[model samples]
Target: MIPQIRSRVLWIVMSGLVLLLASVHLMIGGLDQHEEKSQRLRFLPDGHFLRTASLGYRELTADVLWLQAIQVMGERKVSPEAGRWIYRLLDVVTTIDPKFTWAYEAGGIALCTLVVLPEESNRLLEKGMLHNPEEWKFPFLLSINYAFELGEDAKAAEAMALAAQLPGAPSNLGRLAANFFVSAKAPQQAIDLLSDLYEKTSDPGTKSLLGERLKRVAVERDLQLIEGSIARYRQSHGGLPSRLEDLTTSGILEKLPIEPYGGRYEYDPHSGTVRSSEISERMTLSMKRRRDSL
Candidate 1:
């Protein structure tokens, strides 16, 4: 009985050892296959010549391929299956090289422009920013979308402020922050910021741009003030004035402020309201597109 038990224990131990060897061999084989595949993909047609020239052709090829994939995704009218495939490819590329700024930028642009998902694009930009906090482009893109695309001026102002604080942000970003503040109905703050920027900038081109932006902010603030006064007058009188001159007679406004954009504020007599006549058509279209996509 003791001999039989010893033989059975030896058989079990040998089986276990064989299984462990098989597992290790399989793992090593899989790793070698992966390495071989990576090597083949890393070599281009002129890889030998490029290597002799000391150029990083393999990395450049990866970047070019990333751009091409993003472009195709942007231009194509993709089905769910195609979208999934494209998204997976992008995820793989970004995961392999998290610091590839162009990959992140292209991915964000494609997702926003083609996928029509602002929140998703924002997530991508946020991830990129995590890897590269010094890059101004991600914050700038986020701010522009918040202000113009999302119509959330407060968030836009926050993003613009961050961008302006970054190392290489263009000087014009300060003006963007001011514009965002004005859009959020904080005219005094906007005026203050713009006034400071205009005073500080000495370059002619930058100064001209800042001047135009400040003038626009001033006009928008005046328009809002005039409109509020008109609203109060209507609350008391039960109606708006028939013309701009009527506002003065009705004691609502001392004088009509000329729009800084060189036109009188447009009045809708029937609604007793006024608005900018030359509203940005691009913003209007963007809003419409957003609604349609939703």
Candidate 2:
């Protein structure tokens, strides 16, 4: 009986010890997993910190070192290389605080000025859009790039249209699009687009500018059509018209389209010239003044 009781006690103690050891092992495994996830979330994916460490500065934290590196790169103006550095820094900063608006703005501007390649700048803007697609400025930057730098009016128009669809985009963007279309030489389309914008907007400055642009586009379109008609008439009749009336009489034009800025089109019979009403004598005076100053 005494031997059986001792054996039972020993069995119970050993079982308790085995259960405690198993619990401790599971707890250690869980802690290790949590530590790994925390480490992964703390750093950016690009190995910038790893590179920094490889460069032999072990004392500073990764975030501070990254900021210092970005500032140095910015001061040097090395362009695309600087752009790459800034992008890496921004990635870390954004990962730290996804809602940081200023970081996005600064990152976008840095990408714009330093990248030197429109496609890369565009990719940066797209990344910003992923964070804040409803913001007006990202798409606006894309539109400006397409319109002014790339001279891709169709792409510019598409970007501007997307910007306009956003909640807070400036109303003037519509007028800008119309002007871009006109500058791209699609005047009728420009006229149609601006006419709609003019009706929608009531701001005095915007209205006046759109109205003027619309009139100018219409006049230029008419001038081109008339010029073509005049050329065809000359080909058929072997000479140019002596006056605006001659064109109407010969069925080359029904009536001369008056110049938009308040004057009749002037025709010089001797030189076969058509003069616009708003000729600036200022150019001659400006030249004289510059000569006098020199």
Candidate 3:
């Protein structure tokens, strides 16, 4: 019985070795053209096959495929069609070895920057995040992909928050995430993230800093709501209100949102804009971006 099992193992090993060699040639057939590459991909074993059919040789097969995938991308110009093939190759590699961290990073950057394939990059990085939950780079990359390529700031902030919570993540990641959340127009999300971070962090300095930023964000949020109400009032009444409370009296706000920093809301009747006396405009993201030369 042992001999029979050994023979079966040998057979599976030999078959896997042969298939691995055949699969390497798959990249040679079509890189310059999408249609041809797509056709050749049909012959290559898919992710499921690599995962389930490798006969315990999945790691070896995965390594070989990873090399081929890298080589294909390095040797070719990475046209749109080639990008798709690269995505497939990477998918197969990651499927075979879910813990392959470098594969995810390489694929994430290459797919996003080399071609207009943010969706593919996002999928690969998200899978990396799923498999390697402790690794911060995957979600960091996802945050970047969502922010710059996809223009989804809320998702970007969420991804950055995930990255920030992991060990070895940059300490400023949470701060960056707050900006993204605010830019996403989701001030509550920013408040929530900062609140959570402030609670978990034991460093008093960090907590104090986060407290200040949290109050500032809260102030910004309330001001944004009040500004919107002011706009509506202007449209209906054709002029600015004399005071912030007028909005509440006019049924625009149930009541003015309290400023978190114990400062009153400043209603500029001339411009019809609301500001928080506690949080300076320079402290807000827009002013920061401008100061930073955005």
Candidate 4:
């Protein structure tokens, strides 16, 4: 009886140890397989095939694929084929889960920034709009693509109008939309749009881009004001002034506007034009040549 009891206890302990070892092996195998999958994700089956294979876990499978897509896009260097690869990955993720609005937004913005493909970005955002009619972000992004890349302020205004009408949208979007519709040529309107976009976006890349654009527009606006003041100074004084300071000294301007990039304004008597001192000499010469041509 004692021998039988000891044999039973030993059998139970050995079985538990076997089970623990088996579980550890399974976990290590799963990690290995996951790493392999991530490395070879580009060679995976297409969305249609994966969808069919998801076994009723379409959304879950898509979530995983979307994460992989993000990894692929962020890690990949800029190569000729990188854009195409990113588009394919994003397309697959969207195809599997059409209602994933964040995926669409990220993909659209990535296409624009990474690939410089505004048309493709527009198509992706438009598709997101169709899937998420009640969501305002898609149309807002579409407006950005149109205004910045395509230079279609009218279309941008229309899209912004749609965005403003959507639930949860900001009340001030209407004013920005109206500005875009009223004038395609107004730098102020561009500035307003960019400022709004810069504030609304949390993405560092998009915010940086908007900041640069805003600086350019602000510089342009200051240049216009300086030019007008210069004209007024010449009208009163009977010739171009010796320097930009003369405009302020003669009361044409209260004080010269501060340069957007922290450089003093310079006046060229030979060209009868004012330029920002911060502008590179190359850019100054290019602008002078363009004015001469015009």
RMSD of each: 16.9, 20.5, 14.1, 11.1
Give me candidate 3's TM-score against the actual structure: 0.57
Model 3: residue 269 alpha-carbon error in angstroms = 36
> Candidate 4's residue-wise lDDT over 160-219, tens digit each?
999999998877778878877886434565567568767977866456545654665566
Report the poorest 10 consecutive residues by lDDT, candidate 2: 279-288
Candidate 1's C-alpha runs over 4 A off are: 1-68, 74-88, 184-294
Candidate 2 residue lDDT tens string, 12-76: 76665455334433432243346542232233344443334323322223345344434533453
Range of the 10 consecutive residues with the lowest summed lDDT in candidate 3: 279-288
Best by lDDT: 3
Superposed model 3: Cα runs more than 4 Å off? 1-12, 23-35, 184-294
Q: For residues 148-221, write the lDDT of model 3, one tens digit per residue.
A: 55667889899998999998876778887888887555556556755765676574433554565566557757
TM-score to native of every candidate shown:
0.43, 0.40, 0.57, 0.56
Question: Which run of 10 residues does model 4 get worst, by summed lDDT?
Answer: 279-288
Q: Candidate 1's residue-wise lDDT over 1-294, tens digit each?
A: 999999997777656545533443343234334654223222222323322322323354344435435444644364433344344445544554557776656555555444445565577677778888998767866765565446678888888889889996767778768777775545555456557756755644335544655555565577677778778878888887677677788877888787776766877879876776643323213556767889
Poorest 10 consecutive residues of model 1 by lDDT? Answer: 38-47
